[model samples]
Target chain A: MASAPAQADLRTRLQNFIPKLVLAPSVAVIFLFVYGFIIFTLYLSFTDSRILPSYNLVGFENYSKLFRLSHWTTSITNLAIFASLYIGISTLIGLALATFLDQKIRGEGLLRPIYLYPMALSFIVTGTAWKWLLDPGIGLEHTMHLWGWESFQFGWIKNSDYAIYTVVLAAVWQSSGFVMAMFLAGLRGIDNEILKAAQMDGASNFQMYRRIILPQLRPAFLSAFVILSHLAVKSYDLVIALTGGGPGRATELPATFMYSYTFTRNQMGIGASSAVIMLMTIAAIMVPYLYAELREKK
Target chain B: MTLIKQLKLSAAVLALTATTAAAADVEVLHWWTSGGEAAALNVLKGDLESQNIGWMDMPVAGGGGEAAMTVLRARVTSGNAPTAVQMLGFDIQDWAKEGALANLNDVASEGGWDAVVPAALQRFSKYEDQWVAAPVNVHSVNWVWANKKLFDDNNISVPTTWEEFEAAMQTLQDAGVTPIAQGGQPWQEATLFDSVVMATGGPEFYQKALIDLDPEALGSDTMKQAFDRLGVIRENVDDNFSGRDWNLATAMVINGEAGMQIMGDWAKGEFVAAGQVPDEDFLCFRFPGTQDQVMFNADQFAMFDQGGTVSEEQAALASAIMSPSFQAAFNVVKGSVPARTDVPDTDFDACGKKGMADLAQAAEADMLFGSLAQGHGAPASIKNAYYDVVTAFFNGSFDSETATEELVTAIEIAQ
Candidate 1:
């Protein structure tokens, strides 16, 4: 009996060790490659590095310069606007799509791929395609003219003031479907009995969605929000492909600014400092929510 | 005893194999990804190959050379650098200061580079009196490329002054055509601004404002006049011009939607790609004002240091790049004048010949100035400030007076 119990304990220990062994390499790779390079970049930011990396420390000179640049300021401002609009609009539209699709709409199977396919393509290609489609003279306006609306003007992408919104629209188009999928999955997993009980109490359709369904979908909302926020904060390929931060830097974003400084201008120290500031800004926005989630999980 | 003999024999065989495989593969990085640019690069590649050298091309496609620089910087920082990189203006100096470039003094002297290349080019290509980069071709940024048929149909001749150009544009606009094909991108805006500045303010004021970063010059009445001229250009462009690509703008002129474009000689490549011949389908002229001056920026290949084990093949490749045959062959396809003044003009087009003649004249008169596009004239900060003010004026953000004021402010800040 003692030998049998000892053998069972050994077997349990071996099973537990197998999963850790399987996961260890990937976890180590993430730490060494992703986290390690981030720390290295952070260290470079504090130094007066230029064309090549140097260890001559300059404290916060680079950061002060970054703050002084109008491009940097404009980029950060654009980033804030982009993140809010993209997140708010995408979430609402995604929720609506998911909810509507949950009503057992005809052709739901075909429509799901239609919504999700934009996410399947890279943002660069999407931005290029959208840029052409939204171009005033060549695309929508031209199509409108072909239909005899000669005075049509759909040139938002060309307008300096409205260009960033066009970027937001394209981004939303690409990512809303992803959020829709998450919401759909969450909607499908909800208990039918709860909804039946709500209906039994004579709840209105809108009230049921507002009071019961939305509250229950909080986890999915949080998940979608975090994903969209990450995309917004680090958005570079879209801007590069669409506008190239043009019309006199009106549509410039933090990532493009960092890129221009680091590469074109060869101001690595300033570039690294900007990167650090971006990282800190992202963390500041996300840390509290992450902490709350982790605490709740515990 | 038998095992030891076998090991010795294998070691001898390995050494022989290594010696046979010692050809140095020279990796060259460039930003020429367009069809014409790719064709131009093939000439250089062929020249290098003929020298018994292996050429590894790393081409990144972007109009401004920004993307390629990003990749090059990463490679250099990671202790892995290409043997040569296509660089412009202060980029050479910036890299040279980091001790990232190899000293090409011997190569320059052997090629007789000093006599053939201009002194201004030497200023950018050398670091502390040591040759760091080899000049390939000179691109003039102030040429007015126009559709000859449009000009003929409108009964308009090439403009000789800023006022004449504006009137010509208005004439074209009235005839139901887009007058100026302007790319709304900042660099394109800056290019147009530079052309106007040279045309309106002349070389002296341009040098003071752009190269010297003189606040007074930036705020001068003449500079204001330049901005006003740019304002005219802005108004002449079509409403849907914003965010338009340079090639598309060229296409506008190609398809006869626009009458003219103020761009660098590289615009000729687009014309050539569209099957347009110089002086026949389209014509190239220096922007109005015979004394206006030509702003020149060269594309140079700066050799990076590869330590003591620098391969013989890379040395051969570098030598081949500076050869007269390569200069003539590459520049012919590149739609720019050869950097070497001694190269024969037979292979050049009519406009290219004119460019070469003007270059010689400018060289003699000392009218050639550094261009902002290539970053030769000023520090990056000051250049960007100039760009900011120019772009602001171009985008109708400010009037000419306000632009001049902003220009002075920007210059002062940059200093």
Candidate 2:
């Protein structure tokens, strides 16, 4: 302190402020673009806006209409179907693959990249490829028929009753690899000494995995569930590119329903309301998980 | 030597004039991105360029103009609307009511659009007694394209009545032929249903049920009968019809994999692109029960009131769209009859000529109604509700009576 000059001390003060200075602009951007728009959408949802947003407030008239639409109900039902199957199946498959890969198999490095490659492609690409493969007229069913298996049928993408499952399929295919990578990292983190100890205790492979390693992947499971449920709720591109929410609104998700109402059908208020509902749904899933995680960390 | 010098001088003079052309640059927003549609649009673009007016193409394709309309709405909301936007039916009227559309009375009056354009089309072209849009072409949705060989092989006449159409469909089915090649999209099903509605009842019923939104007419036995026929028509389609694109369905008919497709005149554009001749390679007929009537929806360009350097370009574009030569050239390639009655049929092929004739007959009989699939018969909200119920019914969630009731209920809620 005695050796420092006054100008040098001022320079030190300025240097100390740089990190906050650098972070301020992004903070402002996120505030305005994300939270501000959310508030704006919330305001718009209560108004009698159409094609374009108008400021004439109508006090939940839009919400009443939204609930009355059968299509909106259909979208909700489809989301429930998609989210449960998508999350459950993806978790099971990802965990199984992770466990299989954890067995010290040969060519592990090669197989790891192969399993994770689908995660690198965008949901749009995944959707389109799956659509082509599932379309009965040009895809596997047609090829099978040409090869003298004329009775083979795998046209689930075209059936209204089963169309959402195709969306679930595409979504799981896109995300399961990512989930597997998460579980793999978790599995690698477990102490090798504990496995040897469990082996010394006469624990079989399945018993060790069931009693110890699987229980240790708790955090991974929670993270996977949180990420997957949010993705399932916010899924728009996969539905749009795959079946376009159709075969007659069969595969429509909340995101697609929101876009159609807002942009296509000229019901801005209804669209905004649906978007807010979706946001609330995601919040409902995320808030509790995040709270528990943060409390545990503390 | 003098003639050569004169030619060079004229070429230099032309260059000078081109460089001296006006500073008005027009940005056009549309969804016409398909190959044939792009080529057809080039006629208007070329006409503009020849006049030294520049065209800025802003095209967004998909969802049957829904995406383009979305872009336009966002632009208008942000106060940066384009000079012109391609719109259909009630959309033009909707924009005009918003006071965002430019008044085109000057160009329309000078071009004598009143006498040339039909009265029904003029209903959408004008708003509050002022011309707001220029009609490009009339697209009638009640068309059925069939493989000519299949009809001949089955020894079937082009069906004119619903009963005969059912009989022909049954014959084709018995012969192991797919009776209809339909895409499993809501709008396509709604398009087919619109034709069905007109067939089951007359044009008057169509107006009351669709245009006027009369509850009684919508819930009446006539509407239920239309739904019943739709149920049967659903059975005649191929199992793989779900989620198919309209063009692929058209391809099925062209390749003789399917017998017929009930689609719009745009399907002819596909056949033409495939090198199939109309009435020789394929039979283009009015869908059964829709004879002597035409369900018309016009594609029009609405000029937005950009209010600065863009207004001149907007007027220029409007006048050029209404010009007789452009109408003839554009409609010949667009697979629809010209909006202008004065454009001759000499250049149109067999399908186009038949379209023109039917359009004229429809105009005379007062049978032209806007297409629901093209955003005309109702606003987007109400029309989408109808689509929901109709498509759900077509896919077997509802019986005919229940579908009719649901349609009426949807109208009430949306209205």
TM-score of each: 0.89, 0.92
Looking at model 2 chain B, report the run of 10 residues with the lowest lDDT sum: B16-25
Instruction: For model 2, name the residue pairs that clash.
Output: none
Candidate 1 clashing pairs, residues 3+ apart or interchain: none
Off by over 4 Å in 1: A1-29, A293-298, B1-25, B219-224, B243-245, B272-277, B290-292, B309-311, B344-347, B379-389, B396-415
Q: For residues A1-298, write the lDDT of model 1, one tens digit per residue.
A: 8899899999999999999999999999999999998998899999877666789998987887777666677799899999999999999999999999999989999999999898999999989998889888778889999999988888778776788898998999999999999999999989999999999999999999999999889889889989999999889999988877766677889998887776666567888999999999989989999888768866
Of candidate 2 chain A, the 10-residue stretch with the lowest lDDT total is A1-10
Q: What interface RMSD does each of the candidate structures achieve?
A: 2.6, 1.4
Model 2 root-mean-square deviation: 6.6
User: What's the CA RMSD of model 1 in angstroms?
Assistant: 4.2
Error of 1 at B360 (Å): 2.0
Positional deviation of A249 in candidate 1, in angstroms? 2.0
**Clash tally, candidates in order:** 0, 0
DockQ of 1: 0.42
